[model samples]
Target: MKKIVSSLLIVSAFLLTACGSGNTNSSSASSATNSSTEKTSASSDANSGASEQEYTDPSQLKDSYDVIIVGAGGAGMAAAIQAKEAGANPVIFEKMPIAGGNTLKSSGGMNASETKFQKEQGIEDSNDTFFEDTLKGGQETNDRDLLRYFVDHSADAIDWLDNMGITLNNISYSGGASVKRIHRPADGSAVGGYLVDGLIRNVHEREIPLFVNADVTKINETDDKISGVTVSINGEEKEINAKAVVVTTGGFGSNEEMITKYRPDLKGYVSTTSEGSTGDGIKMIEALGGQTVAMDQIQVHPTVVQKDGMLISETVRGEGAILVNQQGKRFFNELETRDKVSAAETELPEHYAYLIFDDALAKRAKQVDFYKEQGVVEEGATIEELAKKIDVPEETLKATLDTWNKAVADKKDEEFGRETAMDYDLTEGPFYAIQIAPGIHHTMGGVKINTETQVINKEDKTIPGLYAAGEVTGGLHGNNRIGGNAVADIIIFGRQAGNQSAGFVKQ
Candidate 1:
């Protein structure tokens, strides 16, 4: 939910990199890039109307509608589309200058199971395995009903996107997935821009009256029932009446004050979230007596450019990259869940590690090319040369590569118990390294919700006429979020919120 910027400029900025401005020219750990690198920015302009379309002015907004969707990210847009399809009048309000929020920064693909894409690829998968992995990944603290509903409906979400002309047939691995469930664009480009672009196109086609720079300050209620919302646009406040309101205003990972309030231990950690992700919807819902869960359970992604505040997607590790400490030694499984991998990094001598890969991986994963273009990637024609570039000891780096290649050949990992993503070794040159440390990524806690996407109050009763989806509402992720699940959460539940709210309106 960025503010005060032009719509076209903001969208262009998201295309430049993940988040934030400025570049790092230093060769040391000072410079950085992320997996969320928008290499498709050029194509995005040509393909999506997000940059070219005119946003509805505040004067044009209706005094009343069947559904008022807050935040024009993926979730809010999805809700609006579904509401229109369900025979309801829905309008979207985005506080930011642009529509896509942190959803645009996502690099890892959407997670789903038992999809036709997976079946065609001969990859055996099931919702049971997905549910088990997610429960384990969340440390088994997730709401069982919510998790069950999520996994069962994820494949439908994939197909839903497909129906909108967004094909995510490029399947790959994400940490904590039993099989290759992370689905990306068919060309294997990053998924964030692709999904956001597609959703924006659909919203445009439906004439959903999506308004940017329109912030919903308060969710109004009358007689303990949803009545309307108070919105501020261009320094003018207006009360818009609505039968239902959907809060999809994302999480507060980017808000330092809130992050410190909930988790004082993470006071100085850099964040990879969008500036608009200040938990606005959470605060509004909480003021309405809504309940919250796991507020302090903020997640710091393992691979982040500490200086630039950019997130390196876990797809790198999931695609066979390795993590090595300053001493050029492997410590833990690189493909472990973000929390565990980040925890292991904290135990290192310098509390940071380098994601090591070779030309083989760089050729396959397009994000590497973006990293190099940003000057964050250090390259060498040989292992020893790369070690010198990144300041790692040459012999130790060489020995580490040798041992890893052997393990790859033997098809067994005895050191740290890594069993997947061993498709290739580090023999191919030139080698690459990016100095990374943990950065605040996802806020696993927010306003609590039920499987129906209804906002639950402190009394554990559903808040009438109030529904939320995406990072704004929590309990689906529990204590930790698995990669690719966030996209699934927003789309699946956004549609559910729209349908359920529309149904409630009809009743």
Candidate 2:
């Protein structure tokens, strides 16, 4: 928590000093550094009733294209754009009703270092610092080479999006980050809708073919080369061929069975992702003999409404709110990375916690009223009432509040070691609280890939004509993914995959 506040302050000061003027493109080629012999074991052929289907209807086969991308999310859209820009006739097939899958559902914030925004703000952030924070956040179990590559190229990825007019302007501190690299558009909503909108608009402007409601069920491979895909489009099976296929279908956060298989401890926890993120592409590639890495390393966003499971963005805590366990005691620093915070909360009996704040913090975060509208916010004139409303012991809650208030008064969090409290206190009337728990947010594991974005098979070799990016591909975020890094990962790797695929087809 102290680390986050200090970094935010430093970064904010840097932004103010720099005045957002010196933007640098952070995109670069990833070093081909994965020497860990790909233990890419083939997955079971049977999964969720799709892999066993017959692919014999030659009439169902469509004409071949240069590149075929699955999923119309941020990564898929980026891949298609880059593929087209690289002179390939690329087509994107989306399972959703339209383009913009879970990417639309994101807060739309992306992490980058040495960006003009950081420089403009006078923040002393760099790719090196970003790399270090990521490695530590992922517990250093991550592929160091991949981590180095991601940080090295993130700034360029942001610039690439900016060139295409898909730009996010605002910056803030985020979970598992050491500095203020979370960039989003000035949209008061702060959802990834803007990023998705910008990319979708670009897709339309470029006249890229986007097929919605097309779910890829099988990846057709002849010998060692991935030839095409079989997708169920509008209830009819159709075969689409391309020299190269990129799977950007995201992770299986919403798949109950997959979640249970990976994390049985979180079966009852809610999911804060799209239903389309059922790891369709992961399954397709795995069935094609791709190796999955760190399959058990699931990510759970720290807080969400207990009932409907709506995500209350981390910006809430970044502003002024603080979390307390069911006993109304502050358990861990609310500003800890999502994994650590969630792990602390899971120690409680019901796997639940609460976020308490005054109306001031709520207004600053621009979410309390929205949460109130959702009927998830519980308010009170005093701490006792707030605790009672949430069904925790009032005295316990009051003492907890007392300790917190004392810490605030002393300008230190003795119990949890938090930094500045953002100068807001629970003493303000109309205080609010919400019951929350860690909910499955991202699957940090899937298909193994090389730095060039080629999907690696279980035999420690690239499956020719195959590529992937976004959450579906693993080896980027080893044990856990940072908040804004997901957006960066999708776009950066997506562009690389597209460009590489275009080169492959031309060859």
Candidate 3:
């Protein structure tokens, strides 16, 4: 991690010297020195496996452009692609060496309404129903207008990706909805990465420039209006002017400082989001006089692999799996909303739970196979063996299993109201157990944006030449975020922000 951090610092220094307008001689010398240091550090880190350096400084901006998209994640890429398609010269600035932010690490599923897949499956769904489901799932804290816009436009966004040569498997999975609306990409990675790939291809084809390894530290303003950005690269400082700037730098899921301060409950907990999700966009936008919504609300995924912080999608339970407590007792309903399930599980003595399954279910379930392939699953031929492998109590597990078997035989999952008589009992000696904990997944709050995807000030006024999308701009997810809604939010709002930005530039 140190090596990675040092590499990032060196990359930042190089970018600063390459882009900034600092003192010419000093800047050149600093750039060379930083380049040498970066190479040495990167090599050393590679050999020693130290911590990666974090590039926290903002890179100097170019003199001018029609659009500047920060963070290269799903939201940022979508916004940049839309802006360029609308005849605007847009550039994407990424702090990491790689373009895909948290999007790449996602399960590649998107939530949309009234898609062709839903029509084929005979699952009756509509934008209105989608809106109602989102509202209910979020406990009514979400911005109704934004939710409506997201549902109304999400299908089109899917179609737009299809037009751009990105393929969806035409399957709708179940989520927090009356009907199945989650769409998955062919590769089965999160739809965010696929979105990033499509947008990146388009960006390259159009010759849109992307500045990787460049971090934006601050948003520069002049007289209460947007101006440009300030960044440090290669140990030198530089500034760039821009006509419009968009903050798509994602959320602060990985920032311990922010998480501890704003969401103390999640502090020291594991997160599956990328390392770059340190709330850079939130900090930058807030510093620019933007007001954030639902800052205290962070989504906690119910089924993440507790050992190495791997995300085990809730879809596993949707298929057929049981969550058991330390006492070896099945707890909540398997199919309940994440918030309810997480809340229930957290109340347990250890604040830990294990997902128990048989070999047959493991093979059939998407999540189990995914993790197994990733080498994160532990398997055993007996409950005792499984418990020993996972370091749980053998007697406790056996007792729990015995109680559960009785419940199954009686056709009553009384403790958690789970549906009775799930086929394929745990009698199979070769059983499996995966430790799970509530991990930070998403932040339902960020910079406030209107329906047009325009960044709004504390007074609810639009910030001219400034826009935000994705996790950076909140109000889409209220107190809770529905599964697949995050993908919908990024694509739908990203496109809107792009169109709005281009329209503004034209005027």
Candidate 4:
């Protein structure tokens, strides 16, 4: 177990690609980095679910373009595609050998309200309700303007992806959501790899220039405006000129130095973010006089398999799994906000819990099936047998399941007030349990950005020629990020940044 943990850390630090706003499965890391090996038509095997994405070598790129995008994750790629569609020449540079960052490992789904997908399934929803739910989920600390814009434009972003031949028609619930607003692939696979593959394919189809292993060292400014960036390719520095620069380099969740600098309490905790998530864009923008917000608001996910530092997606709980302690007793509401759930877990005797489900979930959720295949899941023929396997009190486990199954059937969680995700009962045979603990998952704070996706300076003025989106920019998620909102943020703000940057260049 120790060897596996050590190897995962080492792989994430150097070779493996991390999540943009998702969680890591070591196999997901390999799938992300596969792009480094297959540059032209970078087609990954079944493990990654990535189609061919053509990328250029550093030597093949032009010295200048209309828009220069740093980071080739979902946000960067989306920005590039939008800029190209807006009649601007955009070039993307990814520091890692691979293109996808943490986005490659996103197992959950994108959140969007008032989408055709929802209406088709008779899942009634509204943008206003989404805003209210998200605001409350973040403890009313999110920027109202940004939050409003996100909810309003999320459905359009879903449509945009749909137009690009990437369909997220499957809808489900996520923690902190009031309804089934989380959209995933029709087959209910992980959304991270699927979204990345679709975006990469679109970028390739557009013939947009994308380079891997190209690190942007500096966001250059000329005459108090964005000029371009200084990048290192093949260990040599090169200056690339551009009319506008979009920094979508993700957040700093994986940067222990940065995390310790801000929240020292999380210094030793394992992070589920991609190693590339080191706040490079935030630091670069700050050096250019940009301001930051909520720099200390890092969020830890509630359910992580600590042995390999793999994140068990919140979708699991939202899909009807329960968290039980060492004594096999259910604790807090399984559908509560991540921060609350994480705090609840810490209050337990062992500071860890097992996510218990049944064959219904194992067959329903693609992630659980993958976990089972990876041998991270323990199984037994029945609930009592599962308790024995996990070394919990068999009687206590049986009683807990009996009570919880009754609650599901009665549609009332009288114990913990779990009002959502009670659509299923754990009555199926061959129950499963995955031991979990909290791990650093997301950085809720970053360089400040306005609704236009322009970087804000210390004076609260827009930084000319500089824009950002995704986890690199703060003010959207506030104190905590809701599940599925990260994907919404990247797409909605990514498109805005792309359009706004192109417009800036046009000026």
Model 1 TM-score, 2 decimals: 0.92
Query: Model 4: per-residue lDDT, tens digit, 1-507?
Result: 222222111111122222322322221122234332444222111124434344565556678999999998888999999999999999998877667777776789899999999999999999999999999989999999999999999999999999999899988899999899999999887887788878977887787777766778899988877899998764667899998999999988777778889999987787778767878888899999999999999998999877666788887898899999999999999889999999999999899999999998877788776676557789999888889899999999999999999999999999999999998898888999999999898899998998999999999899888999999999899899999999899999999999999999998
Cα lDDT of model 3 by residue, 8-70, tens digit: 333321111001111111111122233322532211000011222233223323567777778
Cα-based TM-score, every candidate: 0.92, 0.83, 0.81, 0.92
For residues 1-507, what per-residue lDDT tens digits would candidate 2 score against the true structure? 222222111100000000010111111101111112211111110011111111111222347888999888889989999999999988877665445556766752788999877888887798988988888788887877677878888989988988888776677777777677787765434546567667866776666666654667888877767788887765567677777899898888777778788888877667776656677788888888898999899988888665655677787776657888777777889878889998888888878899888877776665455567667789998888888898888998888877887887788888888773345666777789988887777889989988888988899998888999999988788787878888899988999999999999999
Error of 1 at 6 (Å): 18
Q: What local lDDT does model 1 show for residue 411?
A: 81
Winning model by lDDT: 4
| C-alpha RMSD values across all candidates | 6.3, 13.3, 8.1, 6.5
- Which portions of model 1 miss their true places by more than 4 Å? 1-14, 21-53
Score residue 352 of candidate 2 by CA lDDT. 88
Going through the candidates in the order shown, the clash numbers are: 1, 16, 37, 6
In model 4, the clashing pairs are: 18-101, 18-102, 18-274, 19-102, 20-102, 20-103
lDDT of 2 at 260: 80
Off by over 4 Å in 4: 1-53
Q: Look at candidate 3 and tell me the lDDT of residue 134.
A: 87
Error of 2 at 28 (Å): 36
